[model samples]
Target chain A: MPTFNKYVQIEDKPSMVPAGLEKAITAAAAKDTRIIAVLEDMGFPGMLWFKKNCPERMIECGIAEQNAAVMAAGLAAEGFIPIINSFLFADVGRAYNQIRQSILVDRFNVKFIGREGAWGEPGISHNTIEGIGSTRPLPNLVILNPADAVEAEKAAEAMLQYVGPVLLRQESSPPPIKIFSDDLPFDIGKAFSLKEGRDATIIATGYMLTEAVRALDILEKDGLNVGLLDMCTIKPLDDKAIIKAAEKTGAIVTAENGTVIGGLGDGVAAVLAENLPTPIVKIGIEDEFSQSGKMSPKDELKEHFGLRPEDIAVSVKECISKKEKLRKKRK
Target chain B: MAHHEKLVKDLEKKANQIRRDCFEIFGSTQMGHAGGTMSIIELITALYFHHMKFDPKNVDWPERDRLVLSKAHCCEAIYAALVELGVYPRKTLGTYYCFGSPFQGHADRWCTPGIDYSGGSLGQGLSFAIGMALAEKMKSVVKDVNIGQGGFLQRYVVRFDPLYRSYCILGDGECHEGMIWEAAMFAAKYKLDNLIAIIDYNKFSLDGPTNEIMNVEPLVEKWKSFGWWVTEVDGHDIRQILDALELASKLYGDYRPKCIIAHTIKGHGIPAWEREHIHLGRGAVIMKGIEEGRKKYADV
Candidate 1:
């Protein structure tokens, strides 16, 4: 019903604390002594803010991600909350068994923060253009793929209060803010409606959430209302919202910076296929390792992965047109 | 003191009986790790029935001390000790590897009730012990447990809510896992002198001798390099295992963990099981003819 009109230059780049991740961490740390952080030693001066602010709470376990995961498991088992931070690929590949046996098997309430999911050519090393599929089978894990810094911060804060294991994937670079603060805290297991429409529901996570929101604008201009939901919590999903959207909308497009098979798209499909079958299109990195790109290739890579807002806009328009034809045939 | 000596002597007799019991159990199973079980009997007996502070009546008492059999194939010895110590019923020893038995070949933490951790995987027990020890310190309840009834709602809170010291029986072969080295480094870093890791250095491994398979020779020097107060002893010698453990407890300095390399023969009791190359995937290596290997020597 209402839109924030602080509209500025509207550029693509965003600030590091775009959504309030820093603020949330600061506030959360002040209240809980169990919060300890193992920062990656990749020389990101950005975390110098956290380390300097909470010297007693922050412990860097050197470059050993495997050891860090076990250390976190040990701390969690002993009633301390530890966040082992690294990129998604390294954390998953290096410490799969540790997470499987020590963390998941014990059901220890530890937190894993994978800072970047699929950032194309931040260096191919940083790109997990195909990441999320590998994570779906880990039992009892709650997966959160936040769209922007604000959502990331809120999710991070909400998770510490939870009594089970949680993982939050963060974007190395911030994206456009699609959902402004309701001035109220967001709870886990609920999806936020970025835009309300009836044409088709587009589900997205990671950097693609903002793109989905922008694509909905293009649909709205064409007099076709589109539904947009930021599916932040992928596991123990907001099934009610997804099923309701599918029942009303009849078509969907899911996008993520992860693999197409098991990211946000598959999660939505599993729910819809069981409840209300619908035509769905998915966009993400295919099964291929990312190649080297320009030093500043964010824009180019975003387009390459069909993650640009304009690409989403086109997909949305084509789906609506196809649906209109099919409806006519039904008539 | 004479009475204590008599109890120790009685315990030795019980150990010999347990050796026989283990043989029967292994024989019935038609397949079991006999050599290891026979080797660690006295060590298990001394720790469970005599030294370690535990409550058989209240097994999960938070304050009670913990003993992890890292060399868990010798679980027959642990099970035998637990049965004698009254944690498990004596009848269960007969069902060692029997169908639907709570006991299995190697101790499974999920399956075995009294064992703190299931450690057949090797090298993992040290890490688990480190966590337990750290938790005990953090809880700040520094006392061992005493035997008691489930009554008395306002008991002494057991003087301790977790163990002040933790004992682990590690297999010399389990030292092959690199994770052990990492755990050692961690122990050193945290000044975990309260955590005593004892290597069940029986000279034999499954295939043959550990030294020939992969030398753990100069084991003390290896531990010393990892910043531990290393002690070597005859594993089968109750006095030596006890003295080395006591000496290790007293050697206090920051960043020096304790590692006791207790050496013992693989099959110290049964002659055939001692150094014989029993073929792989075959049963009853120590045949009926050579029960002389079953002779008990006054090695102590």
Candidate 2:
């Protein structure tokens, strides 16, 4: 399959805790009776912390996602904090309509914590690469896809107080351990620039942030100073990030753990296409269904879709070089 | 009960009036549903004028009962009934289907003051009604809790946890929707006795007749399997409809949510409104407009 030499190991069978999420969950649920986790009573301490604080507040309506969505709506109507959890398949498959009608339409303060993406060896139906794009443009649905554990915790704390429907997508594999602190407050509709460059801007959200950082380093080795942006929030995207990234780099390359169509990559490209018209390349899955092989084929699947870090670095370099040539021609 | 009798007696005339109102509303839009609205008038008449416990003055009274209209396209009948009950100015009927009016040829919860849930999507209203009923029951007062005496109910004056009933109205066409079965099975499982779901079993749907599309024959058997107290009535007959509903309300100890299938013909009240293509938006063959909408109503 596809191999990332640095880290490529599954959690013995299926242990549900995807790294840094445990830490973030512990911190976010530290104080708040209104917030509780609805995950199965597995070894995940994050769930344990939630049950400890908000015993009555944390609603567990079984493993049924549809019931969770409906009960969340009921709780929201009655002024209760409701958080629902599951893998991509359960949330998007059964509870899609329920989430649309009851949760989103009612504008309930409900939290849908699930893995954001169509990545890794999660199989075909489990590969929710198109999940974010499909859920976008749903009127008041606010989707925030955090890159790592710290961002996830910050987003969770911020969304807990926000009075709207939030589709919080967390990475199945935590990238950076501590990207932020209690000091750098996480807000909605905002993006952060990690590094400044003059060649190309690489905008990435969710687990793709790690790849964007790596791609930038690869470009730096090639004497190209590439810009990097962490697009934590997908819907109500950080337009300022796109404009700033474009003004500084002149060309852009976008990436996310979702389909290239309506994912963060498109969100970035759509902005540049309209405002700046920059030479941009998107690194994500093309329009195709993921394979349903026996083993989890995350890397192989990503490679098949041309989402490798090398592919991203090469595309950004090529785009920036092409833009430079076009400028020269214009001159 | 006495009011119910009067409604049953005047049912035929009122049914015609409602049918006329439906046609009139449709006429205003030049293109709107006719068959379903015509069939639902009598049941609507019985529910609003007689059955449902609500005051026109206090629309959102805490304890006031509510109706979940699953078939929203028959909004004309609902609007007409609301107006007839003095819940709002009858003048609102004139604005039916008018540009930018609250009346959008469908039951808009915002526009129509008492519509509990906006029901554009079919088969979803019953679930919402269940939530409301659950809220009402859960929010009731338990003033004093004595370990030996149980939770005491304080008999007070204002803000009485008004014993509200949830009436969910469904269409025969809606029976084909899979979600309706889910709602029915859910009602049966929960034993939600306070929920009264009435189905307007008008055989004719938008495309010809329902039998041709999806024959839900032996409908009562289906509901019985779903663990419901099924009651069948001639949809146009007010006495039968009222009697069945009264039987349902008075039923004690049986916690199964009741289902009243009012077997009806689409466009039942109005003769012209139901025949062939005329009722199915085949050009305003008749000035089925409310002013002229009166004649098409075959009340008796």
Candidate 3:
């Protein structure tokens, strides 16, 4: 087993995604009185934190995600920024129409923090990997998926600072690697190039970014030059960075901890197919329902869905060979 | 006549004019929500012309009261009222649903001036109203402060009226949405008394009778059970709607949101369509001929 050298040793605990979100939101509420935290029944430790710190700014809308969504729009209409926290299935899946019609149509400044991906042994019902794909089609909605807790905090701040609607997907199980610094720069539609090379480029998002970095390290040991790009923003995709990567590498592989169908893989593929026609490979769940078991759901699901870093490295190698074959055929 | 009576008479005239304009606009479009729009003409007129506090000149004024037409398919009526209120030009009504017209088929807050909330999808308005009401509650309060000057202290209880009232008009058919009840329970739980939800119980949905489509009977009891102050009114009677609104305004301090179930026929004004299974956009082609003749004769 290859060691993840960049990963820092930290106490294993529940994800700091919610904790970072609560801290950032509470701090923002202190500065901006217009900020309000709207919660469905799903918000846990974060809800408790908000209630304790900024009780006046917190709105518990019960388990009704639909009402929670529309109420956030209404509050936004009245010059208030309402942040909704719920599971991905409840917020993005159930309230998809509400977000599309009420929020996005009017460009309401409502922020949604959707807890996504498998964790805590939750069944397939809670293990939602399609939220990014589902919400990506909505016009006027900014989709942000942070790779780690630090990025999650910055993402929370960025969502609040920006106007209009934003859907920030936070992983329930935080990545073991701390890829970003405490004060790392985070913009709404900008992609972060973690490493740069010319042979092949790996574009990844959310939990899969950490895995992509690990795969890059593995490929480097084999004398294969590879680049790693963290595509945090899914919608209004970083087309500039993607075009740059496509032109430089001519071989692209997208790795995501989501279904390969409509997630980051499809997004990057569309950009490359349109702009550069690069040979591409996608690494993610190949259209299958995730299973829960006694082992850590995150590890089991990642292994079961072929989201391991080794798997991504293999796909990248295969894509590079395809690019070589295409070059020879053209010659 | 007394000032209140004169006001009522003026509002009644405005209601009739709105109904006429609504019919004319829907007829011109040959595709508009006529049945539900006609049913709630008097109630909406009472709110916009008589009860609600709003400034057409400053439509985005923070202190202005808001109206959420939850049953937004019936946007022709709101468009007529908005036109009459001078928010938009009277000629804008002629461009309803025309290609590239800002007057969309449904009530869009962003596209139309003076519209507080967009409501095409049903059962969303009540929640939006609850949110506005909650914001009002947060912003509006009486606070006591002490000021010290020259070693002398002065205390004053500075009280301000609530920011603004939020009125949401929902259709009986819209109540079938589970989110409506969710909003109902949320508003009651938060004691959002400043929010008033008026259900236009016209008794007909898109398919057929509401009872046959999906029974939403015991509406009053349902709202009451959800902790709202329930009141029933003849939706066609401007005076009854005004009275119910007045009662609702008084009940604000009781810490209960108000629900006024306005019983009305599907098409209250148009005789041929009234009491029939008149869903939205139906009978518009027939009404178009009548409207053209009336306009030609200056009979509005």
Candidate 4:
């Protein structure tokens, strides 16, 4: 079972976001004619489908990402919702200033579907973990990183429906098992609580949620009650849910597939430090570039980076111990 | 005088007025990009007064032609145009570069009225113009196709005939950025005939001469190789600038974008301002140049 929660019906099959984005965008395009696809040679699953369906709506911008970014801003200014898809490094990293000055300055309604993760053959050049950190500081830009196929689809739909600039980080990683049920209630900037816990809460995003769910089972078998909070929307972060989690669990362990420096870990830590102070352990790529990792039989990068379910369980215990030590010191 | 002669005379007078307005703006702020701003005055004046289809009464007109001032540091010229066109009061010129003012240091579409694209970064405006051109082409294309009884389909049949043209003004020194060529190739590939670009070949950047700083030499050939219809015009001459822009606007169905290399002095008017390599000036120095420019315009 992928998820031990009663509300979530885990599908037996594994899936990725490129497929989910394809389904979500194509469906969204059918209804809204304003949607346009601006690609940077990295055709992510939906390019061919979009070309076949709406030929004129899909633009092939070639390998020029900077031009593509400003072009999307122009299209957005004209009231057409332009979606630029590429690796996060090329889409955000290469065109950082273009996206900042041209798009985010006036807050254009541009959707960027950036793909990147640690577990891939593309190596460090393509898989940049700094995207979440770099983009989080930009004003008027919303960031979303979905955990499962269902959430990806739902997030894409929500992203399209919303106005202004948004970046949906589609992870290029091993397929995640379906976690959310069909009738999952998804909202922008809101966190979904799978289960409540008394010992510690696991706050995860993107591909790390699958490992988090598995960690929940491991902790349960060891006679521990751990909660899981799916923080899909990284920007405009769900603060109430985080405070509630910290209040209930008194300890938090953050997990993500990207670097923890400016990613979800730091975001959660900032929130907890300000609102409700809680002992926390961050589980992610610790201040390093991602290299080539095997993905077939075993995700070697996950093991190498200490992001496995067992690693998360250990971090949870460490966080709980920190909380206990703090209580003892207060006495 | 002939009708074209009268039109030329009117544009020349408008250009002179805009030059004075630029001086007024510089005098108020005591800081401005004087050299490049003076060089592009005739081009801006002609576009606002004669060429572009903009309504000063309604700045946000849907079908109005767009202008992407890519060399946006010299937005003082555009601000002068807005003042002359009655979009803003003359008092607003005093607020230029202030803490809270619509007339910002650079072209900002949100802050300033009649500005199409927010720009300060060079080599970015051409791509934005292409986008606006593409959008205009899309809108002028097949809105809906009807095939006999009860057969209505929405097809994006990209018709090249766009109702409104999109123009971008670039600086010669700004061509050093590689993204300019990237946008140029994309425009040629897509055959955006509705787009027109003008390069203010003023030869000087902030540091020194453009060729000495980093040459964008053989500039016309570079654009031509990127598949653009290149034209050369004496940028200071109002008649020649209008003629080039007119030819570019009328060259429809050519399946190529147009570029006009406007060779101009760094500061076109006022011999004192033209003599100095003053890309930007502040306080007493800029105030001195504006005074000299006012004296020269009055004498003319």
Best by TM-score: 4
Write one digit per residue (lDDT tens) for candidate 2, span B1-300. Answer: 444555566876776666655555666656666677767788888887777887788877766777878788777788877777777675676787777776766686655677655666665666556645444434443332221221111211223223767788887777887656656654554455667888888777767677778898778999988888989999887888888888887773366678899988876644555565233453554454333455444444
lDDT of 4 by residue, B1-300 (tens): 123988999888888888888998888878889999999999999899988999999988998999999999999999999999999999998888898799999999988878999999888999999999878766655544322231112332444446778999999998999999999998887777889999999999988899999989899899999999999999999888988988897786676899999998887776656778678888877877877888878744
Per-residue lDDT for A64-93 in model 1, tens only? Answer: 565556656655655778776677766655
Candidate 2, CAPRI quality class derived from DockQ: incorrect
Q: Please list the residue runs of candidate 4 whose C-alpha ends up more than 4 Å from where it truly belongs after superposition.
A: A1-7, A44-46, B1-3, B143-161
TM-score of chain B of each: 0.83, 0.84, 0.88, 0.92
Docking class of 3: acceptable
For each candidate, the DockQ is 0.13, 0.13, 0.38, 0.46
Q: For candidate 4, what is the TM-score? A: 0.95
Question: How much is A150 displaced in model 3, in angstroms?
Answer: 1.6
* Residue clash pairs of candidate 2: A2-A300, A118-A129, A120-A298, A121-A297, A121-A298, B24-B290, B63-B162, B269-B298
Q: TM-score: which is higher, 3 or 4?
A: 4
lDDT score, candidate 2, position B69: 80
Q: Write the number of the candidate with greater DockQ, choosing between 2 and 4.
A: 4
Clashing pairs in 1: A19-A149, A19-A150, B62-B161, B63-B161, B63-B162, B269-B293, B270-B293, B271-B293
State the displacement of the C-alpha of residue A300, model 2, in Å, after optimal TM-score superposition: 2.7
Q: Which stretches of candidate 3 lie over 4 Å from their true place?
A: A1-15, A43-46, A118-120, A294-298, B1-4, B141-161, B282-285, B288-300
